[model samples]
Every structure is written in C-alpha cells, then in structure tokens.
Target: MRLNQFISHHSKYSRREADRLIEEGRVNIEKNKADFNTVLEVGQRVFIDGKYLKAQNQDLYTVIVYHKPKGEIVSKKDDRDRRIVYDTLGAKYAHFISVGRLDFASEGLLLLTDSKNVARQLMQSDLEREYILKIKGSVTKEMIEAMEKGLSLQNATLGAHHKSKIKAMDFAPFLKYEVTKEGTNFSRLKVSITEGKNRELRRFFAYFKREVVDLRRVRYGWIELNALPVGKIRFLNKTEYKLLHQFLSKNDKNFYVSKKYI
Candidate 1:
C-alpha cells in the first residue's frame, strides 16, 4: 500500500495529515525518511516522529447498519435536544461514526463504521443508494422525463455575494426511478442514485414544485433495511462486508465470488 494510505489506515492521522508529516520529514520507513508516494511492503518497520508504529490491524474493524427513525438526527450531539441516533444505539457502538447523514425529517438505512479508511473509501465509491419516497401529489410523465434528463438549480443564498460568486449547479445522471403506488392525493416511488449529494433527492422533487411527504432511504450499496426495527443496529455479515470492499476497490458490476478479505 502507499505510505500515506498505510499511515491513515493504521493511525489516527488522516491521509492529508500523513502527507504533511512526510513533507515535514517526520515519517520514516526502515530508518530512512519517507515520501508521500512511498510504497510500503508487508513487515516493513514504520516510524513517525522517532516512535515505532504498528502494522495495520486488519481484524480490528467494525461496520454496522443502523435503522434510523424519522425525527432523529444522525449526529452524536444536537443542541436542539432532539433525539440523536447515537442515543438510540447502545453504548457498545459509541466509537463508531455514521458513514453519511440523514436530515432531521428523513430517515432509513444509515451505516456506521469503526474504520475511517473503510468509511472514506465507501463514501468516495460509486455505490448505489435507493430511496423510497411519498410525495404530496402525483407527478406527470413529462416531469419524470425532465428529471431523468437532469435539472439545474441555482443557489439563492449566494445572492449577497458578487455575481461571479453566485453558485448554480446541475443534478443529473439519475440512475433509475419507478412510481410504485399512486393515490388520489399522494404518490409513492423509488429513486436510485450513485452519488449522495446533500439533500439531493428532496431538492430534486422541490425543483418540480412538489413536496415529499415522507422520505426513507431503504437501501445503500449492497445492503437493505429489510426487517430491522427502527433504532436497531446490526453488523454487516461477512458476505456484505466483502462485497462492499470489492465495490470500493474495483467498482465492478459483477459481484465478486471469492469469500476472501480485501
């Protein structure tokens, strides 16, 4: 592995912090000063600031899926005194961090992991997430086509800034969507996307002049919410973990058959 990746995988410092240490001449491999791109072989001794660092602990990792409920925040502490996900999770999971966040009004499948490297890799990977939403009213086929083709929205908050600083952005390349159920005044649909931009789904509906009455992320990557009760937590089975690791590494469409660890 690259030296900086190794450092961040094994230590508290992040990859950027490790690069800074390398630039400052504080990292060494086998008694020689190391560089950011240095390749580290297994069993090679590593030192940081003249102190020996241990090899990466492949087994000391944890990844869990938490069933977040609506009205509960994804953070550990909330100044508004609303319920937080960590408060629902037992003490055993206090050290883990949520992979991504669900806003106060939205909830569903959320991931928690003890490994920062795993979390970071998965976040940057092109893994798919599926959300099931209930909109306040029916959507026309034309709007669906426009959504599939993508839409652009401007940031009005930047109005106070200079025109050059005003931000306009496009959200496109939506993977797939289907209307599952329709009622007189409500509709339900499933939407899938590869990238989890901040409140992207909600914004997508808002652009069409509709409001989401209920939102739940029922699937993330290879995992599903299934029958897990709200506020419950469970570890990813070996198969799920392996698939996630492989997806992050290769971005393959075919599921890897090997049961080996990454």
Candidate 2:
C-alpha cells in the first residue's frame, strides 16, 4: 500500500496529513525515514519517532446508525467533557471512529464505523445524504427557489460552493428535500445533498438568516436512521450493508483500501 494509504488505514491520520509527515522525515519504515511512494508490506516494522507504530486495526468492519442527540458533538473524544455521542456507546465502540461530523447543536442520524476505509469512501463523496432540519425564520416559495439556484450567505455563494464540492455529484443525482413544516417561526425542512459538506445545510439557511432550530440526518447512502431512538445505535442490516457497497463501488477510485485485520 502507498505510505499515505497506510497512514490513513491505520487511523493515525488522513492521507493528506500522511504525505506531509513523510516529506518531513517524521515517519520511519524499518528505522529509516519514509517517502510517500514507499510501499508497506506485511510484517514490516514502522516507528513514529522512537515509539512502536500502532497497527491500523479498529477491529471488525461494523457500521452503526447512531441517533445522535442535539447536544452531542461528533468527536471520538471531547476535551470539553460535555456529553458526547460516544458516551452512550459502550466500550466496544470506544475504538470506533465517527464517519462524518454532525454539528454539536444538531441532532440526527450519523454513521459510526470501525472501518476507516468505508468511512473515507462515504465522506469523500456526495453520496446522497439526507437531513431533516428546522429553521427559525420566514422563507417564502421564492426563497426556496433562490436556494436551489444557490444563495449568498456569509458573503460567500453557497450554490457555487456545491458546484465545486460535488464536481461529479451532478452524475449522482439532485438533492431531495421536503419541507415538512413551513412555519412563520420554526419552519421544518427535509433537505438532501448528494455531496455532504460540513455545516452545508446550516450555511445554506444562514444566507437567509434562518437560524437552524434543529438538524438531523435521516439517511446516508441507503441506510436509514428510522426508529433508531435517540442515543441508540444498531448495526447496518444485510440490505443496508449491500446497498452501501453498491453505492461505493460505482464511484471511480484508484484504489479500494481493503480491511487489514478483520
């Protein structure tokens, strides 16, 4: 495997971060400085500085649909000691890494998996993630159209942002959303994004100064968070598992990072 892939597969860092470390001569393979093109083989000794290199194995490729509460932050560990989603998850998931982040104030569905490969694949693409959000503002039909056209918020154009974020997202499909509740104070909306961005939903509404009252992810890829009570989690069913594989397989990639220890 490439050095960058090795670093990411091990869960120590991302592929991009791995490149920088290798360039800085911080990573050593068999006690020598490593390069990005270096290939990692089985049973090879690796050391980060003088310490033993941790093998990237979170154990068992398990994907869980977590009903993250509104207050929980989507982090492996929270330094602030506030309530975290992992706090409800038992020690089995202690090593599990979150796939994507749902803002601390947002509540909804999130994917947590032990397999870094799967997480990377889903998060890296705009693979049809859905959300149900409640916004606090008055937005008419025309405003929604403007949203489809993309609006200027925080002085940055969000529609153009989507254009760039999802270069191939167009091929994937248009985002599907349903306005569940259109209220003068708290308007509830179900929005979909083929390409999920960090705080993209909130940012889109921010252009209209529509504060998000609540945001929850209802679906990702083919997995649904339905009936998964808040602070609860369940493994992806057989159908759910197959659907995800099919979704990822369609996306073109140079490599499919295989599971190391399963």
Give the number of the best model, judged by lDDT.
1
- What TM-score fits each model? 0.71, 0.71
Q: After superposition, how far is residue 72 of candidate 2 from its true place, in Å?
A: 1.2
TM-score of predicted model 2?
Answer: 0.71
lDDT, candidate 1, 1-262, per-residue tens: 8999888777767678889999999999889989867998878888999999886455457788888989898876788798888788867776576788877788899999877756776787677899999997887876688668977778622212132343465677678888999876999999888877667777677666667778899888889999899888888887787777666446533423343544
Give the total clashing residue pairs for model 2. 3
Identify the runs in model 2 with alpha carbons over 4 angstroms from their true place. 1-8, 11-42, 45-60, 152-174, 252-262
Shift of residue 26 alpha carbon in model 2, Å: 14
In order of listing, the candidates' clash counts read 0, 3
Across residues 1-262, which tens digit of lDDT does each residue of candidate 2 receive? 7777877677546678778878888889888788877998888877766666677543346788888888887775678788877778877787577888887888777888877767877888766788887788666765567646654343434323343443221122235657777777888877777765656666667556677777788888678888889998888887676666666556635434334321
- The worst-scoring run of ten residues by lDDT in candidate 2 lies at 165-174
